[model samples]
Target: MAPVSNNVVGIDDDQRFALMKFRRSVRDVLKPEHNDHFLLRWLRARQWNPEAAEKMLRDSMKWREKWGVDTTLATWTPPSVLEQHFPSGSTGFDKEGSPLIIVPFVGLDVWGLLHSVTRTDIIRLVLVHLENYLTLARKQAQTHGPTALKVTVLFDLEGFSMRQYAWKPAAEMVFTMLQIYEANYPEILKICYIVNAPKVFSLAFNVIKKFMHEYTISKIRIYGSDSKKWQAQVLTMVDKDQLPQHYGGSMVDENGDPRCSSIVKPGGKVPKKYYARNMQNEAKKEYTKVTVKTGDKHCVDLLCADGDSVLRWEFGVEGHDIKFSIKRRDQDGNETVVHEPRKVSEGPPDVGVLSVSGPATYSVIFDNKNSFLRSKKVYYDVIISVPERDLNMSDEPEDLEAASAVAAS
Candidate 1:
């Protein structure tokens, strides 16, 4: 293995050059705090391919802008349910000085959570915590060196149940979070220790692990309910002074409870009063209505003239089931299925958001061709949103020129 100019091991001359090239191409978007170590994470994720890394970084920046990661997240207040029941905390750092994040996995009441708040709010809550932990790691890196640039997580799977995840919404939320983490925050995990996993956990892990990136999968170490085995492993990486006594460590909360209740809120079932379903009708957005005749398909083409746009949709069929899918056609007339066709019912609108890099047309299709008896009426709200960019801060021209220069070289 060769070393890069930044003293990051395992990078040869080619990778170093690619890193430099990738850095220059995205210079306009780089924050004052971003360094070669940050760029290398993206490069390594894309197998040291500069162009691929650039695309990934640019797309992530667009997502951040749209989600207000830099602007609103700092001051955003989470719903009370989340503030009281969200189960995670950082009581210490790993041996290498990386921030240690502990998640009481069994405390995640996905069903109660989704009912209490919009799915968007749940995702935003996750983002707020992730950003906060990453910020901690960045700060620790100043004293602990690059080794502290990542986070070490301990997921206590005691009482973990697969029942909630059996529900489609819960499962979808898991995948959505995994996808978001892998794409936007690559290589941020120093390690992940999942302890107290029941034997049945293998079944769930087998399915969800498929959604994880190789880098992420490689860092996970799973253990059975044997406390001694897992405790010993944890103690090796985390000092007892920085960990809660409940996990074979010496630290305790101010009240002297071993579980560190002050830091890691033991999230329990959310009260029914907070259910968003009860208030759905109070404020509703209008939807466009259209009918797809029997043996015919209705398609709505949403043009994303600029790449890095987000396409969001909510729809439901009236009185029957309808097959819905999304496809993208690019400048060369190449078509690709963005979402596989799925049968959606009239119960709740099938809602989803897709991040697309496109100078392309996205077709939202409601197919009723298989239904020979009756036409299907679809109620849908679809929008293509571009991140609001500050014109004074815009760097499109310079980014384009840098990309051209890199390509030419």
Candidate 2:
């Protein structure tokens, strides 16, 4: 394989100089093994602008420190529910020696899984696995060359259902994962093969792909349930010995099962017994408690100055139910419903994350006007996160603000 560096192929003298400049700008943080290949990723993501790439790199480094990414693989253990039902595994390496990840997409029970664990737990679980795989890729790169520093994924979406994602919380988690990956782990994927896709998958992808970075979107290939077409393509990149028997490869599990359950866990519906609401002492102390009286509403105005910023919220009502929704109010005072109002009960908290297009005010409203007698007590936390690529380290706090209002009837 050819050396993976900016010096190869279509890159010219100007691009090479930009890459060199980016490397020098971040010299204080780069490891001895952090070669031109690694630096090129950030540069390309920032359109070869060394200064923009530098800010992105520094922001990502801070994010890693905040998440403890360097030590997550050593310290974090996924909850039992995720360990058994996460629906993904690193099964083999591609022809270029990049790790091959297999995900039985249909087995993902997002609704059930969230009910069993916190969203933070799910994010940490993904981070831990990513760290583990990247560590393996880096180690392999020493022998297999720099091309091994990424992963190839196969998403088997045979029985995909849009119903689950239609539920707001499930859709939120999906977009959150996509945004987090694109912001911090840019260019980590060599290619993604999404096979056995149903027609409904297109609708879901159209909505969620808006959250993905261009580099990530360009590497994805989607195909229908034609086994002959996809299997042949997969075989060209992965040897039969490395892939599982179920996916047109010769490898099988210890007991001769074709699905290779030993390596790739087949995630299923999480049992209701594992629901977090059933577990005691689940509330965090950080939530702000607010009382919404009958014939009144509580609204939180999150001002977003930039497009592609994320708005996330987690809240729960005590003893009863409250109608929750999100509305976007543009500069002209035109109001549009972002999330339609729905009744949220006193279990597991109504959690959601949105990639909002802004220069608009987003109102997270808890409505109680319909109730003639009951006053709901709501505990909540709402936040706005700007993309790492767009962060201005010295900007004032007013760029993002969350102000609360209690409107009485």
- Clashing pairs in model 1? none
TM-score of 2: 0.68
Give residue 182's error in model 2 in angstroms.
Answer: 0.6
lDDT of 1 by residue, 244-276 (tens): 999999999999989998898789888887776
Supply the global lDDT for candidate 2.
0.80
In order, the Cα lDDT scores of the candidates are: 0.82, 0.80
Clashing pairs in 2: none
- Predicted structure with the largest lDDT when compared to the true one: 1
lDDT tens string, model 2, 176-235? 677668778889999999999986577457556777888899999899999899999999
Compute each candidate's TM-score over C-alphas.
0.67, 0.68
